[model samples]
Target: MTDPQIERKLIEIMRIINESDRPVGARIIADELRNRGYNLGERAVRYHLRILDERGFTEKHGYTGRSITLKGKEELEEALIGDRLDFVITRIEDLIYRTDYDPVKKQGNVIVNVSYVDKDDFEKTAGLMRSAIDYSISPRVGIFEEDSEDIFVPTGKVGIATVCSITFDGILLRHGIPVKPNFGGILSVENNEPVVFKDLISYRGTSIDPIKIFLMRQSTSVTGLLQSGFGTILANMRSIPQSAVENASLLFQQLHESDIGGLLAMDNESGNVLGAPVDVGMSGIVVSVGVNALAVVEEYGIDVTTRPVSTIMDYGTMKPL
Candidate 1:
C-alpha cells in the first residue's frame, strides 16, 4: 500500500487534473498546491509525478503535460469515499465550535455549493458534496441568491443547502402542520427555472409521525439530480437532534467501515441517531457557474423544469409551516 503521505498527494494530483479542462503541468499543480497551502514546490511535485507515472496512475503526453489514467481515476474515487466522511465531520465541528452551543433544540447542517463549466464535473462535484454530507448533516439543495440587492452575478443562482432539521414540510409536523407524503404528486410552478422548491417542499412532507419512513417523492428525474450544469442535492430528513442519536460512536465507527447510504434517519438496527446539529435554518453554499435553464415540461416522468440545484438561491430558506 502507498504510504499515507504519498497517497494524499496522489489524490490531490488526480483531483487537480480531473478538475482541469485539459491536461496540466507539474508547475500548474505545484502552483495550485501552494495556493491550497501545500509546501511542496514544482521539483518535488515532478518527482512525485514521475513516481505516479511509473506506477501507471498517470500518462505522459509528450511535452504537453500528464493526465490521470484510469487507475488514477479509480484511486481518487476510492480515496474520496474516506475524504467525504472526514469532510462532513469537520464541517459540523467547525460550525458548532461554540461554548454554549446546544446539540439539541434546533437542527444544524452543512451547505456546500460548487459550480463548474463542464457538465460532468458539475455532477461529480454535486455527488461528492452529497456523499460527504447526507450521512450526517441533513442537506437541502437549491440555487441561492446572496442577501444583497446590488449584484447580478450572485443573484438567481441555484446552489446546495445542507441543513440539520427538515425545514418547511418535514419538521413542521411537530408544529401541527401535517405534511403528507407526496406519493405521486408533481407540483408545478410557473416563471421559475430549475431550483429546489416544490421538490423539497413536497419531499419534506411526512406523515404526522416522526419515526416513519418518509413517503419518498420523485422530485425530478433521478437523471436531473446528476445532470451536468444543474445538480440535485441529496438531502436528509431528520427531526431528531444528533444528541438523540443513540450509540452515535458506533455509527461514526460504521462510517469508518463501509459505504453508509446517504440518509439521515435513525438506524433501525442499532437505533443510533448519527446527528448532533442544533441550529435549524439555512446555511448557504456559494457556487458560480450557471447556464440558461430550459423549462421542464414532463407530466408523466420527473419534470426537469425546475432544476433544484440551479434555483438554490440562499434567499428562500423555506420556513417550517
Candidate 2:
C-alpha cells in the first residue's frame, strides 16, 4: 500500500497536471515542486511521474509532456476530500430546494424544460436531469461537467430553482425563466410552457387518497435528504469538522454494513433502522422493495389513476367503509 505521504505527493502532482492548460513536462513539475518547498529532485519527480503513468493515473505524450488521466482526477478529488468536497457541497446545497407546493401547478413550475432533438431521446435528457438533481442535492455526486463542446454547461446556480434547458435529440430547449447575457454568456431562452407544475390539487378520481401521494413523495424525499446529508457530511469531513467527521464516519459505517435491499433511516439519532442487516441475505430485496414501492407510489400517485373504482372498492373493503 502507498504510504499517506507518498499518496499525498502523488495527488499533488496529479492536481498540478490537471490544472495545467497544456501538458506539463517533468522538469517544469520539478520546478513547481521546488517553488512549493517540496524540494523534490528532477529524478524523484520523474520517478513519481513514471509511477503515476504506470498506475494509469496519468498519461504521457510522445517526447513532450504528461497530463492527469480520469483516474488521476478521481484520485486528486479523493485526496482533497479535506479541501474541495466541502465547497462542492455548499455550492450544491445553495442551489436546491424542497417545497409543499405541486410543481405542475406552480406558475414557475420548477420547470425542467428539455430541448432534446426528440422526446424519445429520453436517455440523455433524463440523464441530465438526474445528474442535475444529484449534483444539486448530494455531496457524493461527482462533478461530471467536462470541457467538451458536446457537454452541457450549467450557466446559473447549480441547485434547485436555478433552471436551464438541455438539447433534445438535436434541439435545445430551455426550462424556467431565461436570463440576459452577463459576462460569462447568454442564459437559456425562456419558455412559457411549464415543464413540471406542483401544487396541492384535489383528485376525486382515485381511491388511494391524495395523502398517499404526499406520503410517498415525502418518503422519496428521504433519499434526497440522505443524499444531501451525505454531501454535507462529506464537505464537513474535508474541512475536518470534528462533529461532522464523527457523525459521517458513524453513518458511513452503518451504510456499509446496511442491508443491500433495506432502508436506513436518519431521522432518528440512532445509527440505523435497517430492514435487513448487511449479514442478512435479503438485504438487496429489502432495498429493492423500498425503492420499488417508492417508485410505484410516485408513478401512480396516491390514487390509482386507471383503476379508480377498483382501488376505491379495495380501500373501502379494507376499511369500515
Candidate 3:
C-alpha cells in the first residue's frame, strides 16, 4: 500500500503521465509507480485518475488511456513554480527568452570594451570582460532582449555602483594606466544594436579605454517612454534645459585643477549624467568636447556640472614645437 500522507503515489502518477508524449494506460502508470517503489494498485491508479479528471487536472483521451490536459499541465507547472528558472534554462535552454519569439535566436547580446597597449593584451582582456558582462547581466532573471541598444533609465543612483563592474576589466588590465584615446565608455544592449550617443574622441590607434555610460531619470512618468524603445529614451533625455548648460560650464571650471581623471555630466539635483558625453580631446583642445558634452547633457534632460575630459591629447590639436 502507498503511504497516503506523502501523496508520493499521486505525484508519481502525474509525473509519468506528464512525461509521456501521448496518453498512457492506467496499467502502465500503475506498473511504473510500483517499479518506483510505490505499491499503488491498478484500481487505485484508476480511481486517482478519475478524481484528477473531475478536478479538471487530467482528461480521459480514449476508452483505455488518459492524457494530461492543458489544465493538468498548468497544475503541474503551479506545483513546480520554484523550478521555473531551471526549467527554462534546462528544457528550453535558449539564449533569449521572449513571450513573443524564439528564445534561442532572439537571445540578448552583450558588448564589452577592453583597453590594452598591445593587441595580445586586448584579446586576453576581452575574455575577462565578457565574463564580467555575463555575470552582471545574466542573473537578473527574466530580463530579456538586453543588448548594447537597450537604454536603462535608472530610477535612482542606488544601483550605479553595482554596474561599475562593466568597466573594471579595462581599468584593472592597464594597472590604472589611462588609455591613449582613453576608454570611450562601454554600452551593453539587450535585443538591439547599441546607439552611439556621442562621437568618440580619438588620436592615432583605435580606442583603448571604454567607459560604460547610462541615463538617469527621476520622472516615473517617463518610464513608459523608455520601455517603448532606446531611441525614445535618447530623444527624451536630449531635450534637457539651458539652465543645465550654465551649470555644466560651472562644473567644468571648478575641475580645472583637480586630477578630474574622467568627467561625467550630472544634474544639479541628482548628480548623475543622463546622456553620453562627446569625447573632448584634452584640456584646452578645441572647445567641442565640452560643448558637445554639454549638448548631450541637455539633450538627455540633465544638467552638466563639468565638460567631458579624456586623458589622451590629440597631437593634431597641439601647438607646433
lDDT rank order:
1, 3, 2
Sort by TM-score, top down from the best: 1, 2, 3
Q: Any idea what lDDT model 1 has?
A: 0.37
Would you list the C-alpha lDDT of every candidate in the order shown? 0.37, 0.32, 0.33
* TM, every model: 0.30, 0.27, 0.24
Off by over 4 Å in 2: 83-321
The candidate maximizing lDDT is 1
lDDT of 3 by residue, 1-321 (tens): 445433434555778999999889887787555433344677889988887787787888777688888887877767644543332122111111111211223222211111112222323322332333222211111111112111211232110101111111122122322222222322222233333333332221321111212222221112222334232221111112333344334433443332111232323332223334323331111111112222232344443221111111111222111
Question: Number of the top candidate by TM-score?
Answer: 1
Worst 10 residues of 1 by lDDT: 286-295
Q: How many angstroms is residue 33 displaced in model 1 relative to the true structure, after the best TM-score fit?
A: 1.8
The digit string of per-residue lDDT tens for model 1 on 192-218 reads 222322332222233121111111233
Compare candidates 2 and 3 on lDDT and give the better one.
Answer: 3
